[model samples]
Target: MDSIQQFLPIIAMFAVVYLFMIAPQMKKAKNEKKFAAELKRGDKVILKSGLHGKVAELYDKDNSCIIETMSGKLKYDRSAISMELSKSLNKPEAKS
Candidate 1:
């Protein structure tokens, strides 16, 4: 009983961490993956490096994409895209 009591606090701490931190992180990663996989040509996106461009082509086999920027077309890994920033960038403006 004493050993169980000592570990109770540690177990509760892990539960709290998983619920507050780990769960949200896993959800965000799943959403990001869905966003990356659903990417199609002509969709605007922002890279992790802050460079913005439109999807010019997709290479599913390589898990990469070609982005068309004002300067030129560049290739990047799908994981290099920023999901949150791209969602905000492509969000329709509200007229108010």
Candidate 2:
């Protein structure tokens, strides 16, 4: 009974940490993987550098894509794309 009292706080702390901190991160990673896998050419996305562009081409490698931003068609590693652009899908505003 006394051992339970001592270890209970540690177990509770780990559970709380995992629930609040680790679980969300894992969920986010899974979602990002799903999103990335679903990406296709002509998808508008924003990069980590805050440059917004449409996917000009998708390479065979993971997250490797050619983005057409203001500077024109630039090859960016897949991880460079921060997030996908959900709106403003018409003729591309920025040319390659």
Candidate 3:
């Protein structure tokens, strides 16, 4: 009973950490992976570094892709794509 009481706080701390930090991170990674897998040629996306371009080619085996930008086409890892920015860019503008 005494040992369980001593470990209670540690267990609670771990639960809090998992709920507040680890869980959201895992969810985000899963969503990002889904986003990456769904990416197809001609879909517009923004990189983590903020470079915007349309996907030119996807190398699924290597998890990399080539994007066509105004300057030229460039290659980047699939993980470099930003979900939030890409979604926002693809959203239809609202009229007031």
Candidate 4:
């Protein structure tokens, strides 16, 4: 009973960490993966670097994509896309 009491705080701390930190990270990663997999050509997206472009092509074999920007088309890894910013950019504007 005494040993269990001593370890209780440590176990609780670990649980708190996992719930607050680890769980959200895992959820975000899963959502990001789903977003990446659902991407198709002609979808407008934003890169993590803040570059805005449309998906030109997807290379599933290499997990990369080509982005068509105003400058030119550039190839980048699919993971380089930013889910949050792209989603917000694609969201329809509301009228007052």
Q: Between the candidate structures 2 and 4, which one is better when assessed by lDDT?
A: 4
Stretches of candidate 4 exceeding 4 Å from the true structure: none
Which tens-of-lDDT digit does each residue in 1-96 have in candidate 3?
999999999999999999999999999999999999999998999999999999999997899999999999999999999999999998899999
TM-score of each: 0.92, 0.81, 0.90, 0.96
Worst 10 residues of 1 by lDDT: 81-90
How well is each residue in 31-58 modelled by candidate 1, as lDDT tens digits? Answer: 9999999999999999999999999999
Decide which is better by TM-score, 1 or 4.
4
Question: What ranking of all candidate models by lDDT puts the best one first?
Answer: 4, 1, 3, 2
Can you give the lDDT of residue 32 in candidate 3?
A: 95
TM-score of candidate 1 relative to the true fold: 0.92
Q: Which stretches of candidate 3 lie over 4 Å from their true place?
A: none
- Window of ten residues with lowest summed lDDT in model 2: 83-92
lDDT, residue 50, model 2: 77
**Alpha-carbon shift of residue 15 in model 1 (angstroms):** 0.7
Name the regions of candidate 2 deviating beyond 4 angstroms.
84-96
